[model samples]
Target: MAGLSRPLETELTFPVRTYDIDFAGIVSNIVYVRWLEDLRVRMLERFYPIEPLLARGEGPLLARTEIEYLRPVRFGSTVRGIMWAAGHGRAVFDLQADFEVAGETVARARQRGVFVHYGRMQVMPLPKELRSQMESAPASSRQQGG
Candidate 1:
């Protein structure tokens, strides 16, 4: 399968474990969502420095998430997690992710997160610094030559 490229994205790799699989020997639905979330957070930390941004009382918080399972992921399979910002608005941004095994897509997910003030817990615009940093970061391995 061909890899899809997007701007300002990150890819993480993991091996499917026996525990991640269901009785049918395929990855459980819940595990797929968790993996997607893990990759999304990793991308945020890698490119946007979410920990520091949160420490400063500013960062994006997950507001909603949706997942679509396209194929089965079996135990012992090596999976790749690809994550990137799909869209951004004044207060909310959409993070998109895909799980693939042997270059075949198993699932896709999208998370809508909003920048919020920690103290007030109110939605806020993404900081210019964070946005700029994310925008400047490399989007996909295809472009960077993995």
Candidate 2:
């Protein structure tokens, strides 16, 4: 698989477990959503740990997701999941992810998420420290060599 070169991309490899497969013997659609969530967490952990975010009573909450299923992934398939911050507004940002199996794209998803004040349950801007780090992070931080 080609290494992602996007300015804020993260890639992680996973194997399709038996439970991930559906009655059709292909990986279940819901499993991809879980994979995308994992990628999102990994991306956030790169710049800011969840502990600090929680300490500030902030939470990254998913607002919406749009996914397209291309090819079916079978059990035991090795998939490389890729995610990146496509864009952001004041309190909401867009994330894009691709699930590739054996060099073929199996699925793609776009997600919108918001930073919210946990207690207030209201949207909030991303942490300034995290925003700065994300904006100025080195290229190495963007691409993980597979």
Candidate 3:
């Protein structure tokens, strides 16, 4: 398993949309959660598309999430979300992310997850192929083409 894991990181940048703001005039707390979810999906797309995972009868499910909002993000501000896998053990894994605007981190988050067998809802071991990709991907390589 050691040969198949690493501190894999990636990021995505998007402008804050009108709907992302709350009545308080800043991006809503839930919007940051959505951004983190999107980041995870994009990471999967880069390393392991969902279609194949589903075909294998396995998929990841969130078991926990933790976030600390450092600053409010305003409408039209371009925020970059950086996500990375922090660690894993057998069927469970951990991920971390940060939301930044103009290089200043506005929020930081962590997620705990488990890969489950689709039909049985039983925890499954992390796949070696996925682990190999994670272990080999260069941290400096920002996922290209969105």
Candidate 4:
């Protein structure tokens, strides 16, 4: 049996640029997923620098992802991106992301990833140190609707 899991939290703020808007004048659906992906990578980098992981010949790889858009964000709006690890087991970790504007959540996402030994290209357990780092971090602020 796997031990209890904790969520790792991170927050990011950025302005919606013209390039991210769609024909309807709101953020494109695809862009939301992109933002979620960026947030996940950034969160990992903040807790465990990716460069060092690469040097160690081990890195996390996205195994699957899902996104749900609750609202649209228009160009010029300031949006906040938050990410967290939802669960962790022997070989995989589930991550979640939320996008917000003015304290209102605009979107949410989930991703499952596996730690891999790069050279061998094999799935591996998340390092104990990395898991401890996640467990020790405080949870992110909850969105108005979340």
lDDT of 1: 0.74
lDDT (C-alpha) at residue 58 in model 1: 81
Per-residue lDDT tens digits for candidate 4, residues 26-140, read 9998887788778877777767777887988999888888888898789889998888777666677777877889989888898878889999999888888776665543434
Enumerate residue pairs that collide in model 2.
none
How high is the lDDT of residue 55 in model 4? 89
Q: Score residue 3 of candidate 1 by CA lDDT.
A: 65
Query: Per-residue lDDT for 15 in model 1?
Result: 89
TM-score of 1: 0.82
Residues 71-133, candidate 3, lDDT per residue (tens digit)? 989998999888888766666767889888998999999898888997999888777866565
- List the lowest-lDDT window of 10 residues for candidate 2: 137-146
Residue ranges of candidate 2 with Cα displaced over 4 Å? 1-3, 133-146
Task: Please say which candidate is ahead in TM-score: 1 or 4.
Answer: 4
Q: Which regions of candidate 1 fall more than 4 Å away from where they truly are?
A: 1-5, 133-146
Report lDDT per candidate: 0.74, 0.79, 0.80, 0.77
Considering every candidate listed, which one attains the maximal lDDT? Answer: 3
What's model 3's TM-score? 0.84
lDDT of 2 at 115: 86
lDDT of 1 by residue, 73-125 (tens): 78888999888877665566667788888879888898877788889998887
Residue 6 displacement in candidate 2 (angstroms):
1.8
